[model samples]
Target: MGLVAINLLGGVLASLAFAFVELRPSLPFLFLTTLLVGLILGGWAATSSPLAKLYGGALTTFLILFGTGLSPLPASTPESFSTRIGFVLFALAYTLCMTALLWRAGRAAENSRMA
Candidate 1:
């Protein structure tokens, strides 16, 4: 619950920042809000929901893209092959980082339990 609220706040702030910066005109920073919200919710749900917990990373990313697609952006932004590739690369990196951190934390907890 707390995480959800924090996520919401962060999403709103990022959205505002994008709007203030006028990112890409048609596709603004509101797109990031969806990604951030999805990541947070997916992560939280994955902790207790067996389905989400099993495929949290993929599900979270899909949700993000879906949310972005539903946004009121133009029919087509200034997207190109390179930009799309960059987005995928960044998403992969972000997911890997999150997974690594979670793995380390789990290991630390297990060690403490054994101790």
Candidate 2:
């Protein structure tokens, strides 16, 4: 539940940052909010155990990537090719991380049963 709240806060901060950029094209240092959001997410990731941290990191990356793709950024604003590539790469990485985490968790559970 705390992780979910952190993720939601990060997402909201990200959305606000993007909206600010869209509304004030002339503003400088618009990335500060985004940077803060990253820090929050980093803290969240750091709170978990090693394997769980990897899962959390991958989950966060996947959510950010997929969320950006789905966000209602102005229709007039076109997505660059590199952004698309990033989305795909993160999706694949997330899948692999999830698989590994699940395997590790299952192995631990089995070992506990055998013990």
Which candidate has the top score in TM-score? 2
Which regions of candidate 1 are displaced past 4 Å?
1-79
Q: Which pairs of residues collide in model 1?
A: none
**Candidates' C-alpha lDDT:** 0.50, 0.54
Q: TM-score of each candidate? A: 0.33, 0.34
Superposition TM-score, candidate 1 onto the true structure: 0.33
Per-residue error (Å), model 1, residue 106: 0.3
Whose lDDT is greatest here? 2
lDDT of 1: 0.50
**Candidate 2 lDDT trough over 10 residues, lowest sum:** 76-85
Q: Candidate 2: misplaced stretches above 4 Å?
A: 1-13, 49-75, 78-115
